[model samples]
Target: AVPEAADVDFSDVAGGAWLMDHIPWTEASHRIGALNATAEIARVLRIAMGEAVLSVERHTWRLNEGVTQVWQYFPADLYHLSARFTPNQGPHDQQAETHQQARPTDSQGG
Candidate 1:
């Protein structure tokens, strides 16, 4: 289930940055903890991709442009996670093109 918008907090950007910087990347537990922490951050920000608000996609938390006062969420944490999690890497352009093709067209031609 998606987390509620109110339940998500995006105020820990600095803390998350510190954790990402200090954690020993070689430790498996640390990596997992970082992932969990990222998830927690997502929970707080109420990120949602495509249609569902608050649903995390490919380990990314999507946020509205202006909802959170913060300009960026967990910049360091997300960078570290991206380097550590191969699957979390974003889809290539080809895959994105295919997905776009499959999406139902909107009446307004969106």
Candidate 2:
């Protein structure tokens, strides 16, 4: 996971799971699209793309403030994507919200 890396220190966190579990992420936005292997992604993922690849970009917020951003890439032939959204409740539940699930697939099966 690529973090904003501004004021974050991961030395105390054992792994991504632990970090995520400890933080109360209130909101997040995602963009899923086909990208022909952008230069930065190509260099980072170390693959030469002959066709458009799947790119998932996400930005998460804590208490309505931006916290982290992450990007993931996958070959469309190898994977499918799914997401679930639930609004934060309890002290932050000022408005009613709906639960949503999104499943995106290509030629590959989930």
lDDT by residue (6-75, candidate 2, tens digit) is 3556686554565477675788887877778777766665556554577778988878777678888765
How accurate locally is residue 37 in candidate 2, as Cα lDDT from 0 to 100?
A: 78
User: What would the per-residue lDDT of candidate 1 be over residues 73-110, giving only the tens digit for each residue?
Assistant: 33222232222235556633222111112334579884
TM-score (C-alpha) between model 2 and the true structure: 0.51
Give the Cα lDDT of each candidate. Answer: 0.32, 0.63
What is the alpha-carbon lDDT of model 2 when measured against the actual structure? 0.63
Weakest lDDT window of 10 consecutive positions for candidate 1: 93-102
Q: TM-score for all predictions?
A: 0.17, 0.51
How many pairs of residues collide in each model?
Answer: 2, 0
